[model samples]
Target: MPASASASSTTPAAGSTIHLPKTSESEQLLKIRHSMSHVMAMAVQKLFPRAQVTIGPWTETGFYYDFDSPEPFTEADLKAIRKEMIRIINKKLPLERIEVSRAEAEARIRAQNEPYKLEILAGIQEPITLYTLGQEWWDLCAGPHVAHTGELNPQAFELESVAGAYWRGDEHNAQLQRIYGTAWETAEQLAEHKHRREEAKRRDHRRLGTDLDLFSIEDEAGAGLVFWHPRGARMRLLIEDFWRQAHFAAGYELLYTPHVADLALWRTSGHLDFYSESMFGPMAVDERLYQLRPMNCPFHVLTYASRLRSYRELPIRWAELGTVYRYERPGVMHGLMRVRGFTQDDAHVFCLPEQITAEILRILDLTEEILSAFDFRSYEINLSTRPGKSIGEDAVWELATAGLVEALSRKGWAYTIDEGGGAFYGPKIDLKIEDAIGRMWQCSTIQLDFNLPERFQLEYVAADGSRQRPIMIHRAIFGSLERFFGIMTENYAGDFPFWLAPEQVRLLPVTDEVLPFAEQVLSQLSGAGIRASVDHSGDRLGKLIRNGEQMKIPVLAVIGAREAETAAVSLRSRRDGDLGSLPVAALLKAAERANLERGATLELASPGKEHS
Candidate 1:
């Protein structure tokens, strides 16, 4: 299967000198991965003579081939298969591409009795081709492979795992065995790829979410519906608070739109016709069908069209933390990343035609500011133009596409142009953030839409007193709070920044004698707007410290007889090492300042470190 955004970015690893390019970015890697799959299929067939091969495709990171076998493959089988693949590679077998007619292809497949190959052949168009390995083995594939097997590095490829897959991904079809493997041009690249896979597992958000008590998706509540635990909710509040403040400061007004609306409204917006598959089935309320909104744009559009607006208010920016629901397939529910219900940080700007570039530039500036605060400083940008089956006139598409380009240019950000890759309504700019491990997650989009305004019949009174359709620019910074939270969690590996941590400080009482003092310190910290709590577990000092570290608490304060008597507490910081004894007042001040500044760590040596 092709790797999704959950897979890490193409950026090089943190502090690593080695760079591993994805298969898409490197043509040589593509051929290597493709040929590796054929070699693997040959190996499997050689080792398990009855194994039948189906489709094998190169993924971004690796390749996988589906097979029909009477028995499932085991770890021992994989080892033997690897040995056979090495033998095949060492033989310097030539891979010759042979284009054959329909009859000839069917004859070969019939001779092999490969039913899956016959089905695949019936569906594909001519000129049908096959690739032969040496003189003995051949399979159906239109390949651009290396000249010989010797070109593949025997030490640079590995069979990773085996999983069950249905034919054509249909559950009704007969299930097959899929073998996943990764290949690289060099042994070092293969080593790097393996290291990244391990690191990805280590930083998996789903695992960290449970380990940190952040969130859950219980089967009792059905799939894809998140239950944000207390700690996770608090952090979410902090993020939302910051987002609201940023929007207000950027001169945008917040709107609280309805979660469900009349079904006719969606039909008017074209979602009912085009996006019904993703939407939940409508419910009848008061004899009228109502839909759980799958998008916030249509609601915003209705709000814009509620009343006539003057030219002076042309560039109106309205934002919302709107919760929306969509029908995600059963097997696709992946923690917070893909969910049935999610709160989007949605915003729409209705501007004059002349204001598109300026509004887009402003959005770019705000996007950078908000995402940078979360420590995602590196970005990969794409400017997507109109698709082949898109709405809006050619002139309008050109204007919208040019506006996005001008904004990116004015912001001095380099972006790749994705021709005919935009939404049906308009052109857009997509931003992907590179995490600490170099994996990219898509979180931001700015689309200049001409369809929404036209559909909703939205108009503003111009300076010349004529009603004109205001340009609607739909943008989302976080896209969805749930997905962004997952990305951020993995980005930090659940060790959140001091400002964003649910419990920024924890007070550990060294002894029963220090309980009163610890409570006093906790009061002071909480009074100063710091998220602090006493350990209160009555555990030993060592255990308390260990527990605090295990929870990934940013700062831990230990109160003992000596320290309490001196009106100070010993502190340990996760970001910075052990901070020496500091008075309760100083601790409160530093924490409050860190939260106020949205800082990653508490800097005690700064000018405001000491409290009066």
Candidate 2:
């Protein structure tokens, strides 16, 4: 997924009776939110007569209205708007839908002196309509509103906040104040919505990134550029190593590609025409233009075109952890989830057209294996068909779509069809993983492109000694390394599993006399391929444990005189509480087992007890 596209809606919490559905999921929410936006507009106009309404629409979470006010709205204005909205809701006024001619609509707008509504009227199609609130206030709208304001629970709605927005989202146009608000069927659902929002805030990646000392975005250097600290770098390396191993096991060979190429390469690949907006400006070098790559697919295509291939070399899978850069607008740049510079775990497969089904199945299997390791077993899959403005033969598009559907069926994964949602160049499959908090994050995609192969003339010799274009499949398990890191951080709430944690174990020495013993234990753990460090801060035992817990270390071991003499260590695990006193050898064995199995918790047995 692109950095600009963030995660989707939240699901109902487990064991909770209240289910907070998104506006898209429920017809009642659609009507309620739609009516709420109009009610809010009426209240705003009643309070600030000079505020002219532009547009008010419902979102997945709630609704927002844009207004061209004389002055920006303040925090106090939001409270006043809420109070006024509640008052209007209490009036039990009938919301009447009125059909009018364009002339009448324009006449009413002229009478009200609302220029924004006039502009909106000019763009819309015929059968103009407006909704009247009570007897005095009204606005142009297409009605699916509640019968009356009495149907709305005044206590169920809230005015969220106010922000500045450009009219029609164009920076060149007039600026407007946008008021965001949320409404639900009942106050209980509203409470649940607020709780989820607060929980999301608590698990925000930016705060966790700082508190855990993982990564940072330095303003001095630039915006949207990530600086991975030592601990973060270590965890990233672990992820990379696992990715490499998984790809190799799945019959993939890794490749290294340049970050910048001649500007003509992009033109030949058609990216210069289609993706120029997201690309950085080209740089002049030696009388030629070189541009930073916003994608890795073109580079892989270049590699395939560089050499002629035979039929026997079909189904070639090549993967790359390629770093790419794009130009993100300043205000749109988020933490690690949305960055200008990030690594893409990109892979491309060149195979015969007939082998699409098998190749897609292989990719899906690998995706599941990799994602399940991080404890994301639940998924929502989407199969997007070709758009109307797409480039491909009808037969080819049908074949590609069929291949995706068949592969999904063979894998027994349920998917929803999204009409006209694919890229202009291909039909694709998108997979969204559900996080621990019931939020869904899009991280994996498999796109079958028929245009790239034709554009680059990527071909191989057929069995009959004729040349044929190879089918190209672009796949990425983690869409962007930085974005995936952010999602995973929030999913785990910064307390990473034992196998993936940067510091798996911390050794706390009881006193000065046990320093040497702690060192020996650390060496043993390190030799066993466990990341362990001796806490040499010389703080009290209680403080040491507290600090270790604060850092979210998986395990904390206490080294004391008796344990040292007995060749044992008292262990406290974040996932498994106290394990009593276990021998150093047992600790090393359990740590190795956890790493090998990618287990979340370590299982260690006492001297005479059986392992659990």
Best by lDDT: 2
Q: Where does candidate 2 clash, by residue pair?
A: none
TM-score of 1: 0.96
Ten residues in a row with the worst lDDT in model 1? 1-10
Per-residue CA lDDT of candidate 1, range 1-612, in tens?
A: 111232346566877777888888889988888998999999999888899999999998889999999989999999999999999999999999999999999999999999999999999899999999999899999887899999999989999999989889877788899999999888988888888889888889899899889899999988899999999999999999999999999999999989999999999989988899899999999999999999999888888888899999879999999999999877667889999999999999999888999999999999989998999877888888889998888887778788888988888887888999999888999888888889888899998888888888889889999988888999999999999999999899899999999889999887888898888888888888899999999998799999999899999888888778888888889988787788777777788888889988887853322211
Angstrom error of the Cα, residue 281, model 1: value is 1.3
How do the residues 287-354 of candidate 2 rate in per-residue lDDT, one tens digit apiece?
A: 99999999999999988888999979989999999999998877677899889999999999999878
Error of 1 at 595 (Å): 0.7
Model 1's alpha-carbon lDDT is 0.89
Q: Against the true structure, what is each candidate's TM-score?
A: 0.96, 0.96
How big is the positional error of residue 422 in model 1, measured in Å on the Cα after superposition?
A: 1.8
lDDT of each: 0.89, 0.90
**What is the Cα-based lDDT of residue 252 in candidate 2?**
98
